[model samples]
Target: MAGEELKPSTVISLADAMQAYSAGRYAEAEDIGCRIAAVHPNDPAVWNLLGVVARMTGRQPEAVACYRRGIAVAPDYAALWSNLGNALKDLKRCEAAIVCHRRALELEPDVATSLHNLGVALTAAGRDGEALHAYDAALAIEPANENVIWDRALSRLRLGDYAGGWQDYEARFGRDELPKRDLPGMRWNGGPYAGKTLLVAAEQGLGDGIWVARYLKRVKALGGEMIVECREPSRALLASMGVADRIILQGEPLPAVDFHIPQCSLPGVFTPDEAAIPTEPYITADPQERARLAPIIAAAAGERLKVGIVWGGSGTYASRADRDAKLAYFLAHFNIPGVQLFSLQKGPQEEELKALPAAPVVHLTPHTADMFETAAAVAELDLVIMTDTSVAHLAGALGKPVWVLLCRVPHWMWQYGRSDCAWYPSMRLFRQRTWGDWTGAFDEAAAALQMLVLQRSGKLLTV
Candidate 1:
């Protein structure tokens, strides 16, 4: 279509493939695109469409191959270059992706979408300053693009520019991919809303609710009775915080309130700088619940350094690859002589323990029903060691000693280049020095655990 003419039948087939792709029917699109690529190997459009479909279907290697073939046929095609860049980015080949994106821009400099994709690849590669500059360029071209604004918000937050970041973070609502609640009431923007009841509905995941629960107390101080609506799993934990005047679980009838706000947006209310963030433990396990779970833990631990471990987060998370590790990997490294490992992991990942030759850790997931119960079990333990999951937030909130293993590029909240968390003072972060490599992080954690065991037994002297 760019400069060459195709047979009427071929053109019709290509149009059909494009329509199928737009309808989210990946199978239909891929079939048509594959047929066309076989018949018309000389046309870059066929390969480009196939590449796009491959990327959508999560076959990143196939997508890269398709894009490369298309680029070979039509070296000047900016779309082919851009698509190749995206596929390479998905494969975590950031340097190659950056080169392809730059070539795309060279061919078509004014294309804002190309710039936005470039920014994403750059951010993934940890060149955040350059990424921000690219995002700024894209925004200058299309100021109203919500997706660009949302990404820019993440970069700004990662850089610790909380005030500016929160301002742009509001753009999240404009993107359709994120969940939205059409609750009954005007959304609370900020400032004092005296004498009026406010409903703070927890958004995203369980970890999100725990992380933002710290803001509820401050919201209450803004002169209104605050109501917290969270997932059923977290109701008890939220109730224990005593931050909200009333607590309601999700799926229940909405209580009448004058104003409603997403729990995650609470930070935007004050636009708090780093120093203003509440670092103290604001959540606790129910004392009664903790007492109940203590004996079970003590009987199993038998004076060894009691440690709880979670090797994975929720599978639905987009960046789970970077954030999660294999359960076998943890078992391999954490086989310390004087340490007792307890499994606090929930979700389908808990099944990974069954495939093991024998139970390496004490299975506590059976005793722990929800986040609150998990917290009680965690309270009885000497320490919690886990990947970045909801339990990490729970332990941190409880003021328990926690070691959080992180990927090279973690979430914006974890920020960049620090061994300790500002949000959780008791948290010690063990980050992977190389992308996709957890050996260094795991080895360091193993050494630290051994030291902890020694210190507890008075075998090692501490200053």
Candidate 2:
């Protein structure tokens, strides 16, 4: 529908554009929005809508231009300002977005959306205190609003307001429709399903599965034969959890059960008073896996320090912009002492890794099946360093001494201002000092590597 030429003389012809956008035809939305913006060059709303379409279609620069054009046309339009702010945010232009949001609020004082948005932009820029105040302002107007509430909660958590944060975090379920146990209805947290079958299925990502698997033990503890299911890639790892009586892979419809519950929601269902995150590293690797790979690793003489490394996860483009590190951050210490850093690279970061020198890296890339093989190789590693990727989880599961490079806005599970993973006691976190700054994380990690080298040689170096 966005492909249709603009037929606007007075009113904006945004109907087809909206339709194309809803149908996920990003290109079509961009085409129609562009045509409409060209036709009604004076209309700010047209420009704003065009900006939204362009942003969604991944043409970030065009989107920014569209927003600027709208502001020029209707400088007083608060909605246009908010729209512009979001576009700037999408482009990682937080300071500009902050200005736009502030202007929008000055024009429309009761604009809760603007406040909430301003808070997020500020949080992205690492101004947590100001962000909290902004979110607080938004929530004061619209208390029960889920988006505002969840966002505020995130800010609170980021600022270490765990008392308020966990309460808000508990209300997270009604916000989105995550993966669930595909039974007729939702999982029953009620006791004594003595004669009945229930599916406590895995929904969401592998990290989510690992986080949620904590409740499976309680489910099994209650005599519920919970069938834990996630993607095939995580089957081996998920299987090791003693809570799951049976591990099922995704795409295979599970057997009918009396009731179904998403494993992630167990926190909401069971422990409402306090979230004692069952965060001990329960997921483990097979002993046989360790045995099978020992010979292969033992052949590589004891001289070189084997290091397993992962650069990226399946992070979204916006998420990746902040969470991911430049390859140089991981590669700077490649020649530090005798460490041989093997590439456990996955997703889009593969091409970037290929261009780096091969001396430190061993590419066992996309073809590898299961974490066990990865674990098998990791068995030889003196240490592992990874961004918040699945490889970190794998190495942790295997009880490897892992140094996880953390983003400023770390994943929710990591909480705030912590350097070690409570989930995996063996894991340590090297955090970025500034938002999207990997330099500090790499520098700290490099220094830690130097200490580890000295320690391995039975020399305790003072910090």
Candidate 3:
């Protein structure tokens, strides 16, 4: 009923454009699609083809405009509505995206793809309960849809359903995003390897490596020579744990181990629920590194409450910006009288400090050569405050007093409707109430820091 208005000639041209898009020739597809759109401005297929090409080429705004134009002409077309919803979600316009997706579902109620898109939009809006229902409805229609299952896993995990979530999370290995590991040994089945060596292969972000490092001690207790393979940046930090019989940097020669388990999968093996999560301080700062940095920190901080800060995480994830807080935002709000801010940020983002006019925070990247050095610097601080990042995991692992600034819908591990972190007893979570709003979380952290300073000063005076 929606696309039947297209002429036979227009349909043939649309097919050619779709074939080009399928073959990954987006430019060719876009050229053909644009030509059709110019000639047949009223045809929904032409606009849909143009929108798909625009989205595939990473021009999400153009895709939204194309979809809007198509919807104006053919409002009954469910595909255009669904495409618009997806583009809006990519732009972080969750509420509008949800409405667009629901409208598409109203037009094509049985379409699993529309339901899946709606679920994703709902999740972004932090309405994960409703998101789960949408995902379930999609799964009921297309029982083996990996896209639907994967998103449902995230929703379940965010809602603190670790058991069901982890079970479904195994679907990630089947998906392309996480990348499958092709190691030498047999995949360890989470059982004891009494006489054999167990290799813990690290995967994903540096924060994930640090978060899963806690499971190494548990693996060692299962009675085997524990070998951990980690990225170069995390090598020193994992080595300091002392749980692994050997720490191997990633891309090095594979050691002869009887069994191998992905570092992340270790959680699924051991942790059944939130209460089963291992407590923090499993990771320790190199004692020598700490001793070397402590005097330097004392010299700079003096009597001030030494506060370390990390404003951004790794720039890999598309959704990372949601979790990032601007350095200026922190400096503006955290103008407490007794606190001295220290930058623990690395990577290209550290350049943001130089661009700023009068940055009060002391830059500590020069002192931090690796995770060991970073951990030591963090240990010297009275408290660590940061957006959700690897440094937050580092500080949390070391059992330091760390406050984490969270997006409205943060990572599954942060959970929903909670201020305390189960994995890190010393870590406190400050979450945004509204989507894409960091000011609320930052303001709360500033207020909390003021109280912490007063508490510490009162304790010092008593002594």
RMSD of each: 2.7, 4.0, 3.4
The residue pairs found clashing in candidate 1 are none
The TM-score leader among the candidates is 1
lDDT of 3 by residue, 1-463 (tens): 2334344698787898899999999998888877777778899988888898888788999999999999999999999999999999888899999999999999999899999999999998899999999999999999998878989998998888989998778777767787776787888988889999888887888999999888887789986798898999998878777778998888899887789988888889999998898895787788899899988889888999999988888898867878887888888878678999999998878989878777888889999998989999998998989999999888989999999999988998898888998889899999999878887888888988887788887854431
Better of 1 and 3 by TM-score: 1
| Tens-digit lDDT track of model 2 for 402-435 | 8988887777556567887766777899888766
- Tens-digit per-residue lDDT, 1-463, candidate 1: 2223334587898999999999999898888877777778888998999999999999999999999999898999999999999999888899899999999999999789999999999998988788999899999999999899999999999989898799788788857757566886889987798999999986788999999988888889886888899998898878877778999888899988899998889887754798888888888788899888999999988988899999999887789888999998888888788888999988899889877768769999999898888889988998999999999999999899999999877888888889899889999999888689999999889889888888888999882
- Stretches of model 1 off by over 4 angstroms after superposition: 1-9
Task: State which candidate, 2 or 3, has the greater TM-score.
Answer: 3
lDDT for each candidate structure: 0.88, 0.71, 0.88
- TM-score of each prediction: 0.95, 0.83, 0.94
In candidate 3, clashing pairs total: 0
Error of 3 at 325 (Å): 1.9
Question: What's the C-alpha lDDT at position 454 in model 1?
Answer: 82
